[model samples]
Target: MRVRPELRHLFAAAFGLLVGSAASACGTDAVGIDACREIESARCEATQACGATEAEAMHCIDLYRDQCLHGLQSGQEPGADATARCVEAVHAVAACARAGAATMADCPAEPLVAAADPAAITPCVVIARKPEQLADCAFVAKPADTGTTTPSGNDAGDAAME
Candidate 1:
């Protein structure tokens, strides 16, 4: 499926905060601290599950973990607000994954490519936190403009129950 250019950039960049640029498979809102921890744990767990065959997912998340967290808390960077928002978005994505709604494997080939659609490789990027049980994951993976150009917003809060 062809992803819209602007949405692609927005989605990719948000996910990029974790996995790399849109180039790699990689969020919005503020979730609780528990949700943040759960997001990280869930991502690592799913990536690990892909195992040896999916080294890309595991390595990418592992490589970016520290930097991603640091980016949020770095005084020289975005600061605590950004950190909270980022952590929240991360929690939303991780929550989606744990529910078996998405994974790193959803990313297409050449995931690290900046132009790649995060919607494809990381369904977590677009997955809704509303907890719908529809048979099709279309709504889950569908990209909705959350009025957030940055990696922070109420997207996670609106979509997710947390």
Candidate 2:
């Protein structure tokens, strides 16, 4: 998703704060601090704009752990707010996955790209698919008869179906 220029600075600031917290928590080096900063920035931007609930936001944060922190330590530029952004992106994708499942009758199919590049998926898809279920839906991964699907949203439906 294209971040608005006006919000970009705000996201950056939020991210910087998150990263700073992470760095201080971990007590790492300058590179680690930089990586944390970047990750936080991306995460903040994605989360604010992701339109996901508090639970999804937390999930996204978990997803960003490796890409945002480890990649930086390994000397790889994981992109802007790589970790945090990735987490947010994954959460968005999860939201989409869940919405898609509702459309297909509780059997939300996982995105083909989920394993390859989950970050590419956006929450807009989820919002588009399950407009009514957003508040009630929760993120859940279902084992389909054909394969596995990770549905992002409230898991209330899954329980009802089972």
Candidate 3:
């Protein structure tokens, strides 16, 4: 899934803030051993703020976080790494979109389709890495806690606004 253009700035800003406060990309707390927790937190928070559904928010968390941690260096991460991750995450989302995946909301409106074609989706993903372009899951794993429901917001129309 692709985040709306306006939301990308918000997501990046959130990432910056998380990095600033956390002081370390991977804080070795009592949580899981994953080193990219902070990045995942920032991405998911931004996704929620930008009006992504819980599922979409989780999807963004998984993709970007995995991309960040995958073959990552040990210390403060580089933006280039994230940018590359965004591209990869977007590709996963694009494949899902092309496969007619289910979505919580309508995808972005292109010329005549719900969202940009798979070819265009990558560039679009390159633009907004938040990943909410599809209505359903292609490669993204479902959230573990589906029975619990947080109060939803107006994220249902978030993609269409793009």
Candidate 4:
């Protein structure tokens, strides 16, 4: 049976919308650029409470927006939920501890490439008192395996073969 051309187009459009909506529902979209600044500001305040000079705090916060924008563009930053969690973690810090430059244990780490390349560092790193304290952001362990390697199927099969 031939599908009407218009109906085919309509079906494609509907499928696209469904896929997009599903992704949105699953929170796959990264946090917006504004989140970068918000996290930076909160971190700066915490640091300032600890003893950071106003100038130092301001400079640190200033770097976050542009750097975060860069990270987001680079696709190396955390998603919206991760960023939000980081923000909350920062906010939860005791004023004195934050002032003392305590590690933010809950915040996501800067991506490895960003860590090695200053230009790619995420906004989160901008607020880090010690960037190293933050772990590397989770990334795929390695590029997709492109080599051809048939699975042995099961441990029993491998044992029998051996």
The top-ranked prediction according to TM-score is 4
Ranking by lDDT: 4, 2, 3, 1
Q: Whose lDDT is higher: candidate 3's or candidate 4's? A: 4
Question: TM-score order of candidates, best first?
Answer: 4, 1, 3, 2
Candidate lDDT values, in order:
0.36, 0.39, 0.39, 0.44
**1-162 per-residue lDDT for model 1 (tens digits):** 999999999998887675654434333232233333333333443343222224554454454454344222111233445334444444454545555545434422212223233544454443223211111112112233652122322122222221
**For every model shown, what is its TM-score relative to the native structure?**
0.27, 0.24, 0.25, 0.37
In candidate 3, what are the lDDT values of residues 1-162, reduced to their tens digit?
999988999999999998888887565432221424443444354444334567876776666555543422323333545444533443444343444534322233322123324444332231134233332211121222543222211122234312
Question: Which 10 successive residues of model 1 have the least lDDT summed?
Answer: 131-140
Against the true structure, candidate 1 has what lDDT? 0.36
Worst 10 residues of 3 by lDDT: 148-157
lDDT of 2 by residue, 72-151 (tens): 32343444444444445435544544454333223233333223233433344433222112221211223335543344
